[model samples]
Target: MHDHRRLGRELGLFGTDPLIGAGLPYWLPEGAAVRHALEEYIRDTERRAGYRHVYSPVLGKRELYEISGHWAHYSEDMFPPMDVGGEQVVLRPSLCPHHAVIYRSRSHSYRELPLRMAELGGMYRAELSGVLGGLGRVRAIHLNDAHIFCTLEQAADEARAALDMIRGAYAALGIRPARLRLSLPGPGGKYVADAQKWRRSTALLREVLDNSGVPYEAVEGEAAFYGPKIDVQVADAAGRESTLSTVQIDFHQPERFDLHYIGADGAKHRPVMVHRSVIGSVERAVAHLIEVHGGAFPAWLSPTQLVVLPVSEAQLPDAEAFSRRCARAGLRAEVSGERSLGARVRAARLVPYQAVIGPKEAAAGRVALRLRDGRRLDALPADEVVARVEALVSARRAELWEAEGGES
Candidate 1:
């Protein structure tokens, strides 16, 4: 296992202080960079999947959770209550209830039967202090959460779309598809509401998986109390499995919240809801990425993508010019003007790759790219260098990308 605390401190990512509340992470610049990259990727992906982003308050009336049934099933994981104007309020632990409210705020017709709402859901769950680790486990987490309100007939299609989004996300992060597993909710009391509904929902999910030719395991009693879900498990470098995403079918919430839409028959009918997350929690995904890549992220995902080292003071101008060219090409490049080539290279290894340019390269109008593993690709044009870097980052080719960094 990666020494998470050491990695966080060494990378200047984030750290916990005794004075600061436990389980809450204060992101430093580097950490925030990684987080922002993740957010941008997920937001773009959600948009491509037709999810409308929305924001919800951090706190809501206690009755919201009560109606959502979270008060009964997950109350232990919630924060302490607050008395507000003779009514109880609580921090929002999930975004489903808020989504329900948003759905009801606008009148709906069968024409808009599949409305998908997404949020980078910042939520609080009262976890034990000891369980919290750097960006892996935190008190407050931003979830790539979304809810799809679809006609009962559209549930399967909506679920297939959610799974596709999840796969796309993992691929963008350079995670192998084979290492991720999907789990269908098991039989019995694992799901809330009627047994008949559970059976029907499971059948629907199974059909979706089969029609899509997506293989999934049927795990018993592993779903949330409110609904039957398709749970995603990701395997790390050491083959340890972690829950990363979920696609759930909810039949109860629409009824509990008294939500409905006008149907073809001009009658109000309850719409089925699909709850999903590509990356379950921002904090968790960061932690997984750290281990998955062994703290060496790909170019696009790297906090500091490139460090330019000048061989001597005379080469500073060339180094600056090269770095500027890289920046123009959307590569994060930094100039190491004051440091020796060797020292700069050593320091750059702390990041991913170093673009070490010297007088020879300046005279040649080319640069030798240094990989983190002590190999050098010599005498490549500045534009070719930029293109290669961009391709590696954009593709999220972590294995080759990290090896490229290591070779330098």
Candidate 2:
């Protein structure tokens, strides 16, 4: 198995310390670089999709979850509540409750029915030590969560659009879903006991899935306490399956928090909440990416997208200047010339792009370009090379050479 725990260390991606506890893992510079790129990509994507980003406290008052039903339905997986000056607060296990409160803070009109709110937020879970391993299952989770407050007639379309976003994201990130799961409440499950609400929500999700024509399994007991959901399932190298993306239709929160909007008839009406995640947990997504690509990430997602190496000590100045130029052009670039040319090139073999400058090429203001797949182009002008790479990275193209035109 291409276990991320081993590969993370081998690639200088992440680390853990006993003092920081087992469930928490810290990102090394390389890992953090990849994570930052992912975050920016998701944020840009969300912005383009009309999502309004916000920041909410990771800690919430105890009564908050009680109203959202997390205290009753999910407290077992939550950290123990802390008392601050005789008031109880808990680290949130999910962002929906906080988002629900944010929606209720202001009045809304029918025109703003689909008020989409997004957050790249942190949530905590009390996972058992035995079940925790690597980034796949950690106590501290960085979630790419969002909620869409739409009317009843708009719920299905929003869910479908959310699925489209998920598919777009998976294609861009080079992720393949093992399965599509329609997660519904199981018998005797600890779910909100609202039969009509459950039926309506489940039917809406089913309609979306059916209309999309994507094959999926309807699994009982895989749903959230508040509603049913569409889960995008992915498997690691070891064939262990986990959900990396999800979409849910929640009616319970809008009612619990007395959420409403002014309707066209000038009457107060409840809004249906659609919950979606492009990348469920950032950690698990990275862990899967590491295993899926075996650490040779796509160019845009790679920590060090380009590495410039000098063929000899004499070319160091030229190589360093060229690398700085690449960096200035927004490529994650660096210079590596301390070792022999062959050794340094070999070290950066998995890197997406390598520019090897020899004495003649350096003097000519050109580089011997090497794509990670072992393709080499000789004596390309350094500036032209940078332009190709910059275009490729900015476009998030999946293949080299193809990015010069179309994706492969």
TM-score of each: 0.88, 0.98
lDDT of 1 by residue, 119-146 (tens): 9978899999777767767889889999
How does each model score on lDDT? Answer: 0.80, 0.93
Lowest lDDT sum, 10 consecutive residues, model 1, at 176-185
lDDT of 2 at 231: 95
How many clashing residue pairs, candidate 2? 0
**lDDT tens per residue, model 2, 1-408:** 488989988999999999999989999999999999999999999999999999999999999999999999989999999999999999999999999999999999999878999999999999999999999999999999999999999999999999999999999999999999999989887899999999999999999999999999999999999999999999987898999999999999999999999999999999999999999899999999898888899999999999998888899999889989999999999999897888888899779999989988987999999999999886788999999889889988888766344655
User: Distance (Å) between predicted and true CA of 286, model 2?
Assistant: 0.3
Q: TM-score of the candidate numbered 1? A: 0.88
The per-residue C-alpha lDDT of model 2 at residue 88 equals: 98
Residue pairs clashing in model 2 are none
Off by over 4 Å in 2: 403-408
